[model samples]
Target: MELSCKVNYALLALLELARHRERGKLVQIEQIAADYQIPDRYLAQLLMTLRRCGIVRSQRGAKGGYLLAREPGQITLLEVFTCLEGTWSHKQESQAASLTQAHFAIEEIWQEATMAATAVLQRYTLEDLRQKRDEGQQFNPMYYI
Candidate 1:
C-alpha cells in the first residue's frame, strides 16, 4: 500500500507527538514541520484535518499548539489512515466480471488481500510506531560534541 505525502507527514507529526505525550506537551505545527522538513502550511492543513476528525485537539492563543485527543496506545493506524484516506474502494475494477468459478476465485483473492491489509493496520497503534522508531534510533549515535 502506497502512502501519500500527506499521510506520511501526518504519521511523522503524530509520532513526534507520541514521543512527547508523556509530558502532556502541546507541540506546535512549526516545530513538527521543521523537524520533518515539511511545509508548515501543508502540515497545518493536515493537522486541522486530524483535529476535525477527533484524533487531535488544538489550543488557541499564546503557548498554543496541538495535542493528541487520546492516548497514543488507544489510536490505531487504521483509524488514522481511514481518517486521512477515507474508505477503501476497488477503483481498479473496471466492470462486473462473469459469474464463473475463475471469477469467484479472483474475487476471493482480492477479498482476502483487503482483509489481510486491514488486519495488519488494525494491529498497531501510534505508541507501537513510536517504540519501534525509538528502538531503531538507538543504534544511530548523535553527533553532538
Candidate 2:
C-alpha cells in the first residue's frame, strides 16, 4: 500500500494545476517542478503519461504549457492512480488454482482491503484535494517570546 514517488509527483503537479484551473491559464512543467521541487525531466515524463491517459493536456508554442483535460471536480483520485499505476488485479489465475482453504481466506480478506482502498480513492477528486490544501494553508502558527 506504499505510494509510489511517481504517483506523488503526479498528484503534486496536478494539485498545482488544480490551483490554477480557475484562472484558465496554462502552467508550464518547469514552474510546477520549481514549485514542488520535482525534477524537471521526471515531471515532464509524468505529464506526458497523464496527457496520454486523458488526465492532462499540453499546448505547444512560446506560451506552451499544460493544463488538466477536465475540471478538477471531474477527475477522481482513483482515475489518476490507475493512470499511473495501471489497473488493480488480484492474484494470477495460476496462483489461485494452487490455493488451499487458508490461502483462500487470506485472499478474501486482501480483496476486501483492496476494495476499501479503491472506494476511498474513488470518493475524492482533485478539487477536494485542492480544498483541503487551501484549508491547511489558512492556519498560521504564532511564536511569542
Candidate 3:
C-alpha cells in the first residue's frame, strides 16, 4: 500500500515519541524535527493535526512541548493511520471489472485484504514496536542467514 507523506511524517513522529516514552518526557517539535531530519515547518503542521486528533497533547510556556495522549501500549498503528490518513478504500469496480461480476465478490476481496492488514497492525502497539526496536529484531530474516 502507498503511504502519503503526511502518514509517513506522522509515523516518524510517533516513533520518536515511542523511543522517548520510557523517560516520560515531553518532546519539543523542533527536537523531533532535528532528530528525524524532518522540516520544522512541515513537522509543526503535522504535529498540530496529531494534536487535534487527540493522539498527542501540547503544552505551552517554558519547558513545555508535546506528549502522547495515551500510553504507548494503548495506541495502535491503524488507529494512528486512520486518524491521520482515514480509512483505506479499494479501487472502484467501475475502474477495472466485469460489470456482470457480483458485488459480494469484490467486497469480500476488499474485506480480506483489509482484515489481513488490520491483523498485523493490531498486533503491534507503540510500546510493542519500541520493544521490537530495542531488541534490534527484524520481522523478516535474510534467507542466507
Candidate 4:
C-alpha cells in the first residue's frame, strides 16, 4: 500500500506538467524539483523513466525541457502508478498444506484491498487531480495580494 519515492516524485512532476499543459510550454526539471522539494538529480532520473514509458516528451537546448505526451485528461493515475511502480503481483511462496483459515481470510482482505485501490486509481486522471488540487487550494490565503 506504500508508494515508493519514485512514484511520488513522478506524480508530482507530472502534476506540474499537467498544470502548465495549457500554456504549451516546456517546463524545466529544476523548476519541477524546486516546486516539489525533490532532489534535482533524482527527479531527472524519474522523468527519464517516464519519458521512456511515453508519458512525457523531452526536448533539449535553451527553450527545451519536458512536456506531457498526451492531455492530462487522458492520463490516469493507474498509468502513472504502473509506469513508475510496475505491475502488482499477489503471488507469494507457500506450501499447499501450510495454509490456515486465518491465513485465507487475511489473503482475501489483501485481494479486496488491492482490487479496490486499483479501481480507484484507474478512475482518476491527471485532469481530475488538477481539479482536486485547485479545489483544495481555494481556501488558502493569496500571498501575492
Which candidate achieves the best TM-score against the true structure? Answer: 2
Q: In candidate 1, residue 27 scores what lDDT?
A: 94
RMSD of each: 3.3, 1.8, 4.3, 3.0
Relative to the unseen true structure, what is the Cα RMSD of model 3? 4.3
lDDT of candidate 1 over 1-145, digit per residue (tens): 6888878999999998887779999999999999999999999999999999999999997899999999999999988989999856654344556366776687788788888888888999999998899899888977987
| Model 2 per-residue lDDT tens digits across residues 1-145 | 8789999999999999988888989999999999899999999999999999999999999899999999999999999999999967777455656878887787799889899999999999999999998899898778999
By lDDT, rank the candidates, best first. 2, 4, 1, 3
Candidates' lDDT values, in order?
Answer: 0.87, 0.92, 0.81, 0.90
TM-score of each: 0.87, 0.91, 0.79, 0.90
By TM-score, is 1 or 2 better? 2
Off by over 4 Å in 4: 141-145
Span of ten consecutive residues with least summed lDDT in model 1: 89-98
Model 2: lDDT to the true structure: 0.92
lDDT of 2 at 93: 57
- For every model shown, the clashing-pair count is 0, 0, 0, 0
> In model 1, where do residues sit more than 4 Å from their true spots?
92-104, 141-145
